[model samples]
Target: METIGWGILATGKIAHTFARDLALVPGARLAAVGSRRAESAQAFAQEYGAAAAHGSYEELVSDPAVDVVYIATPHALHLDNARLAFEAGKHVLCEKPLTLDVAAAEEMVRLAHRHDRFLMEAMWTACHPVIRALQKRIRSGEFGTPRHLHAELGFRVDAPPEGRMFNPELGASALLDMGIYPLIVAHLLLGPAERLTATGDLSERGIDLDIAITGRYPGGALATMTASMTSYSSRACEIATDRGRIRFDDFHHPDRAVFTPYRPGRGSWAVEPGEPVVVDGGEPVLGRGYGNEIAEVGRCLREGLRESPLVPHEQTLALLRQMDDLRAQVGVSFPV
Candidate 1:
């Protein structure tokens, strides 16, 4: 095919979103889908109008028509799935958190580089234009050299003991799942953190119910983020800068956010709509998942870029390293 063709390796909810979004981009094709079960793969393909489906991951990766693969398998399989795609000479966009831990993420990045393939941790929030706008405004001194951030991503999960989040074999934890979002967003706005203080409550099976973390980055910038699988949060992330604070209504994966200028010694702030960057307001793309990341993978394939600047290998690794440390502090090690 002349256009970039995508192969989705997994039939999870996020995978469906990715596929649905992939269709939105011009010249992008939902070429195929792969699932552990043939029925699941076929069902996903039919739902997304994809051309083909494969029962096994290897089959999907090696499909000649597929220019790239989006791996939305669980965290534990991220490394393996991405490596298989790279070996098959296809670009890969793996869902976050990129792997179970930093070591796995590092190995995956190395594998991609060694094999000369594009690889990216599909942190969809990073590619979001609204997020980009926020980052730019913050960096441009519009937010006055952002000094602090308050963020959280959490929702109660009352799954059975054998559920994915509670399954030790799945490398499950709130820090690695819900936690990565706030950490990554902190990195985006405040850059790498220099100090981290974290605490959490773990389940009997070792899953985290919640984690509250504080990071102090270079230049005294600080970010406090909390994530949990046992509670709800109204605000996800916020930034307080030297000048003013930026507010994200739904901070982690935001659709619409606003910037308020902080005037020194002034009781109130100014919320200047930063051009109101808005995409088509409609039902979300659901067949595969967030289409922007899938489209980005396709764009990289077409242009031959080895990775997404938005979700770089180092960033994923660093964030995971921090998360690993936090989990360690809380004594929440996965069985693996």
Candidate 2:
């Protein structure tokens, strides 16, 4: 396979991580780095060993050497950055939350389809080996008929009001930034929610500080998820089924999970538990598993795939719509 040239559209922390991970991917090269400031872009390029550095996103997207552009900009800029890349005939692997809202995400998807360019929301968790193993177990019906799920992700960030976590202008909200993790795991395990209810607390800046969501799936499975930036949480997920329960600690980037089977004649609330089987994610590729998604993008590009089957366009839209609905319920709206 020919090497794929990657242009990073931002010099943010996420961009640094992606560039670091790109080094681990076979046939993937960090061909360019772009930022609003020339100094920032040049520094990132020097650090990442990119062949080119552009002072502006337009310059980066227009680089003929860049086969794909990774949009690691803030959520607010995703739509424009992605559009610019697609217009330049570059495939896109955008940071999750895709855009500030469902409408923006839809527009990006439409443009990608119309342009015949590959586009995928960089939900790296969807490409992890651990997640694949869990999917396999679910498909094999090892845990019969999932009934309930509980997941949470939270951390305390004592940033000032102007910080990204509390700034509505920057598309800051616990639900969109941190809460998406729990939502992603729920979607992966239980599929889209048929109905959902949400409650949240907001900052003085009108940003969501915390959010709690409960969803009911068409299959009768129930999910409870919570995300917060003002508190600390275990960041875990548990899926209960007729046969047993699967527990994943730090579910966002899980390294292992445990399945505890239920014995016959034991009620769902019974204390008698069977032996627990530990499933490890095994050794990840370099860059702590981010390479998985990078590899997936490379494979899709090589195969002429416009979107990954694992993280399809429909899934991204569905998730975005869910977030939109949740935000509406909580009365949270971004400037975008």
Candidate 3:
């Protein structure tokens, strides 16, 4: 199909953002929305120009009108939503850290391959134009990436006892939410960490309040990163290479990256300012939270692709494995 019909499976803030953006994005249309409550679903559809609404995820998955399903539900529900969508013969593009663990993620991948359907982890930063440029720079030897990298993504989520941020059963934590950014940045620079040293503090409900991780690559490339929900820090992502370094403004969300190259003659560094370098960072990317991600799903569908090369299965697996290890090191465990 020239344009994709999106079935959004949540009515959360991100869902609302995505629905709004989908309205404006090329190659995308709001086919339907799903939520546990029929009223909520109907209200969302009416507010967002969706042609249909389903009170339950099952109905949304089975909606014959949709070409793709954008699983914007919580991480714990991603696997199920993907499976349902795959069964319904729809492509799947779910949010970051797609599943609670690698095992679940593997199942979703296996099913997608088995069903001959497309499935992609919604790591939007990986597909963002600015992050793509950074990757190209490193691949081109522009940065001579032979050294270390550091990325930090955190926000103050001072939730009360058993709130999502502190609730293990809900899979709430900074690492799964904000920490994925640093992990993705590191993964782009250095494939998988050969050696990982990690630790973190747990909330009262045993969810990770915060975590600090250090990963060593095969060639001695290393990454030091942190994620926290209890406190706030610089939402910066930096990749250091043998010749220079690249840093991003705020979160990697919108990809305003700056490059610094070592200057032998100057004995310091030459810099490429972040986005809008020519004029305050170019045309800023205004967005509905899920807009770009929905477009990515459409692109994959039109290409007859099963997985996004930008947010490949292996990378998602590796990042989740890293998180699992980090959580293990910190002794965070959820009750079954």
On lDDT, the candidate that comes out on top is 2
Q: What TM-score does each of the candidates earn? A: 0.91, 0.94, 0.91
| Local distance difference test, each candidate | 0.79, 0.89, 0.78
What's the count of clashing pairs in each model shown? Answer: 15, 0, 3
Comparing candidate 2 with candidate 3, which one achieves the higher lDDT?
Answer: 2
Instruction: Please state the error at residue 222 of candidate 3 in Å.
Output: 1.5
Write model 2 residue lDDT over 83-146, tens digit each, in one string. 8998999999999889989889999999998999999999998888888778777868877778
lDDT by residue for model 3 over 155-267, one digit each (tens)? 78766766556667767877889888888877776667887887888766677878998989858888899998877778777667777666776646644676666767765
| Sort order, TM-score high to low | 2, 1, 3
Q: Which of the two candidates, 1 or 3, achieves a greater lDDT against the reference?
A: 1
TM-score attained by model 3: 0.91
Off by over 4 Å in 2: 264-275, 281-286
Tens digit per residue, CA lDDT, model 1, 1-336: 358888989888777666667777877888899998999999998998989999999999889988878888778888888888888898888888888888888899899889998888888777776677667766777547878889989998888887677887887888888888888888888889898999899888777888999899878998888998899877557777776567788865566566566555556653345533332223343223366666666666677788877777788788888988998888887766
On a 0 to 100 scale, what is the lDDT of residue 318 in model 1?
86
Error of 1 at 306 (Å): 0.8
Model 3 weakest 10-residue run by lDDT: 275-284
Q: State, as a TM-score between 0 and 1, how close model 1 is to the true structure.
A: 0.91
Question: What is the number of residue pairs that collide in model 1?
Answer: 15
